[model samples]
Target chain A: METYFSAELTDFKTLYNVLKAITFKEYATLRPMEEGLKVTIEEMKCVETSAYIPVQMFESYYVRPQEDVKFKLSLKILTETLFIYGDDGNLSLKMTYKGPGFPLCLIIKHNDENITVDCQIYTMDVDESTDFLCLADECTLNKVVVNANQFLDILTDLDNTSDDLDLFLSPNPPYFRISTTSTMGESQTDISKNSEMVLLFQCENEFQAKYSFNYIKQILKVMNFANKVSISTGETGLLGLQLLINEDAKQMYVEYYITSMFEDDR
Target chain B: MRFRALLVDNAAMKDLLSTVNSLSKLSKDCVMRIVSRKVYFIIPDEDTGPRKPLAWCELPVNFYFKEFNLDGVSQEYNEIYLCFATAMLAKSLSTVKQNAKSLKIKLTNKQTPCLTLEIELASNEGLQNRQLVHDIPVEIIARKNWNDFAEPQFNDFHVSIEMPHLKPIKNIVERMKNMSHSLIVSANNFGRLSLQIKTNMVNLSAHFTNLGIQSFAVGQDNESTVGDGSANESIVTATIDIKKFLMFLTGMQLNHCRTTCSIVHGKMVKLASEQVGALSLQCFFTELSN
Candidate 1:
């Protein structure tokens, strides 16, 4: 099935800010003929998620979709205000999307409320939409598909990571400690929870590789609905994050891996 | 017993002693007495002394200390207040008495139907030696330079006297004067003031207390002609809490003066000393009479 989804960066940033606090990393896949993007955030370790905007109701006002509105449109909003919509109405909130740029689109939904935010993303024009879809009767899915260039733009500008651990765990057998450092960028940066970071380490085989901090942060970010996380490691430093995506169902597990970038010497 | 580190520095030892005496007027609980002298060592006798002497004395040693208390972070600093008083008194006395005709000055108003400075510094025994002295109301003299000092003379402030071989008091006075930078620190009502002073560079500050010193401008946007540099000096500021000092400043209604502290960048600098880095001064207005 070939489906297309599109939205704005402002929409995604609003959604990211709202849900990022609830989930480790948001998972969105494009489904042909679907109304918009489908974002599923795993729920397990609430502590893993750094972004958490609560769901609420609001006073009057309604949004109408323009029939002639252009599809596949992307725009960067640089205003300080972040717009959020509740079950009742749309209102501004205290949040800012900071990375390399201003416009971002990755909206998530819960109940009748929908959320998105704007992060200035820098990328040469590219396409990343996939026709992958999931069907569920009880669970709620929220998403916004914005221009791929806007998302790629943000990825390209981020030449450095944006987080640090107070200290490193001792390196046993396969795991070797690399440099544990922080940022000293030129411009005064607004330290945001949504900032992208890369965690590096050297290890033995595929199973021995320690989980990257980014992967852990991402999982903890999206699957915050659960209380605990069970981690399993395998061949060549491959860390498996086993998470409970739903509350009532404990048997269900969503998994992902930290791909070898080969860019890091360790 | 944890004590506050009080460092007082002035040009004359007599002046330093007098300041210590002034504090006695405020509170009698804290007292300053000489503990040791230049190479002279006064050991306690096995005999519990025919009579217990109050002040320890001799040539070469001079420091008077007192306990300082705030909410309750007792430091028990060593040679703290005494070092200050000693330096100041040495400087003050060095200025007036050059050749040393016995001079008398009152240090404290005590019914010393008792203790004498000489008895304490000299013998570990009997009513040591005595010299009758009159209290001369010394006029407050304005010093033109910071290094100016006077010689030590017997003051009527309940003190004892003794003449013995002593090192050049001038060398000692000069050393104490140079060491004065470590005693005075710049702090405020909430916390200790902190700043990093570069080598040989004088950092000038005019705080809120010195607001009335319109003649000495600080924090102005204009470049100060005092040194050659771009007017735009980088300033790093941190927040501090100095509630005790604030209460004292407010209660006293003092017009703090502007101060400039810098290192004497020469070959003979003591790198290991604690006063090497940033030194700050909180200058308060003394009686004006040049």
Candidate 2:
């Protein structure tokens, strides 16, 4: 049990805010690998989300030889603890995990105040990851890429009482349509193929799927930090939403898989 | 009893108002004791359940106000004690803090005993002088209960050290409050202060060193001095309620005054600061036995 891991990051604000946006759950599983760290959060085994932070994001990254180095931690606590360094100024962060059953330690150095914070956060047993049907291959029936900010605007216009969201995709007329129905009446937002927001529209056949409005709204949390978002649907009604958080040298990705509700189920 | 004062300086009035506003966050009501030329606001220890620490604030009557007058209970005892809702007074002061040229505070006996504040605002556009009056009702505590508000004394402290920059401490303590209910503060006479929180899940500690140690006053014995060849080099430690400590930190965020924190091992923690000729704020936190 003599394993040691340490990593350093220069600008913590970007990484801190990105992790905070997806902290809707209490516990998240953190898997530290040689390449980087992978954090996965799930809700009721129905909606699973993961963020892949590659090694290039850290100023200095290292991992000793270890097998199955995964632990469960409270996302809420981790996010709150990181923000204590504040948003302004250049904050340098050094994180370490001594070994198995040892708490994860974070040392934050604030440049302006010449202050350092050493925080030890407890870790729990890692839960098995939820395996969702793969929709990355030819099984992806429909895929569309849109500007994240524009999609957020469309989501904000939705009626508060709407329960179901219907997404339509086509290769020709009315390239994309997102409509919601509730007692307040029906609201629909349509985007044409020639619109600037629609970056890519690839539809093998005209496909449509129905997903819970509340589940789809979760994407709004990450919309501000993401530049572009890609939405795709599988033949088995699995919706994949990928957000491009940063386009700099250290690219980050936050992806969500929401199990869609079929038309007949409603 | 008759009490009246006039404040002419806007900056002094604003500072006094903001300090009172911060004090109001600690408790809803407090006793304002007025002596001949000094004013004291005291919040005694609440004995209803667990120990609630006391707060004592003193201000010179002539510092912020230009004209002052006072009529106490009697000539021999030249002091007046009145219990007033701090929130109400702070609200009235905040409303007229900006435009008021002069503020007059008086004790009035109307439908109810009230502390009347008359704010005279600068005229806008050839209009008549504008005045706004707010009557904040208060309860005059009888002389029998006056003995309860005496200043607390904790003479024997293990370590007394000046605090570091408040901005960083405030940021860390605010987060600690969210994680745990009690905070453990430990300091050594060698200029090292540690803020820690421990629970079944996690134990977190922040160590700050190279702080200035305030010299003990003359004739005061200095025991528990670090690096003095003492057998036990244990740090002076006390666990205090995190909420109260955070409130003190929040109040310090607004003022430029320096703060000194003194801790009695496993006994109590006292925080004291004063602005020359203006006001002083002191808070006491009784240690919680583990």
Candidate 3:
């Protein structure tokens, strides 16, 4: 079988965990480039998430580049297939996509048992636009960097029923604040720019934006494993988050872009 | 009925507390039967209790209590049976594992039938000890209904094998539980055990070998309670609810215990703990709901 794109990973957990976090949707588009593999999943066409896996992350990565090898597969089934051995023994994964119409073949080898499991996940043509909303690239107005775990702890108290989550970034007192009001009552969290948890703070202008609480809640699924989060906003009230996911000292990036809701929507 | 027990030994107190804590996960309520020699925690298995099979545990009264006294309805049946919520009992003994200098458990009639647990706390100041009391209401079972709380019976099992320490399999089963509701667990007399789960999407199985196998000769009275495998090299398997199986592994609190997993071939699966001087816990999971 001629392989268009193939990558060997010594451990499956690295890829499995990253995919599991972004698995809000059934299918996600995967693009294999010279640099690495990019997996993107979009919701409602307004909110999008992309995970960048560099070539260095793989034990061996090969690509023939048959006119930009790209396909979409079920993220739910793919993540489940990665850990088929069920948390026991050492597992190595060999993933291959053979040109077009061929299923993404995953060969998982149980290192301890000397057994191998072969899975063929049917790939489909990408129907959604592969474009990722990079908020930090242009129309940027504010930025705030904080430890993801700490931020996640603060966000846990947010009432999910709250329709909108307000974000305010300023150079004044309580430089970064997140406030929400719902049936459970109003709750607000304030963090100063000088706080030790804030790694980097850049706010050229006082900016305020509101996002759907449901969309903001999606980050919590993956934020626990992320080391740090870079929060950025555009002039048009677009919010962007670049999460630095550290596992076994290896760094991976997952970017999330959320379109701010109109203030009158609430 | 009158019953009071004083537990002063810290090690025994912790053991008793651990047993109760483990039993708390098996059922909402359990029968606490008190005798002169032993204190039995019984959740009698009934046909109605199919989803969650009953658990039976025996803790020697001499090991836990410094003073053990009980008066039943008659001298012939010198035992008291009390039905209480396991969570409440576990909550009352939760502190006993930590700073319990002494624990006195007595049946009290202060406006209600309750088992008042009075625990003497060890103070860091080295001054007078502080005290904590918890009143947990219990239903005193009548003597005529005592048959309902009898010890569970494991009649016929096909293969019995000694299972490895559950701490290692805890995460493995937890993850497999997500894949399927029923996990087929099988073992043979040749020291081989396997856990397999079959679903519409995937068929996955893990095999563990070179383990000790229980001999059927050990089953003198209760044929399958101590585990029995009369056949050799023949695999006997039973399908068990994956969640309940995980519970059995997680609820084991006693340390350095040998667990025997016996399967009755599509009928039932039993996990019985064996530790000399330590309380024995037998967990039963009926076959095939999924």
TM-score of each: 0.19, 0.90, 0.68
Candidate 3, residue A16: lDDT: 78
Which of the numbered candidates is closest to the native, going by highest DockQ?
2
Off by over 4 Å in 2: A1-4, A129-139, A262-266, B45-53, B95-101, B122-124, B130-132, B215-233
Candidate 1 all-Cα RMSD: 24.3
Off by over 4 Å in 1: A1-83, A86-206, A227-236, A247-256, A260-266, B1-290
TM-scores of chain A, one for each prediction: 0.29, 0.90, 0.93
Q: How well docked is model 2, in DockQ terms?
A: 0.52
lDDT of 3: 0.80
Q: What is the lDDT of candidate 1?
A: 0.25
The segments of candidate 3 whose C-alpha lies over 4 angstroms from its true place after superposition are: A1-17, A29-37, A61-251, A255-266, B44-53, B98-101, B108-111, B116-126, B129-135, B188-192, B200-207, B215-235
> For residue B53, what is the lDDT in candidate 1?
15
lDDT tens digits, residue span A70-159, model 3: 898877767877766666758788888997887787777767654455667778887645554455585467778899888898898777
Docking class of 3: incorrect
By descending lDDT, how would the candidates be arranged?
Answer: 3, 2, 1
In candidate 1, clashing pairs total: 97
Give the 10-residue window scoring lowest on summed lDDT in candidate 2 chain B.
B216-225
DockQ of each: 0.00, 0.52, 0.11
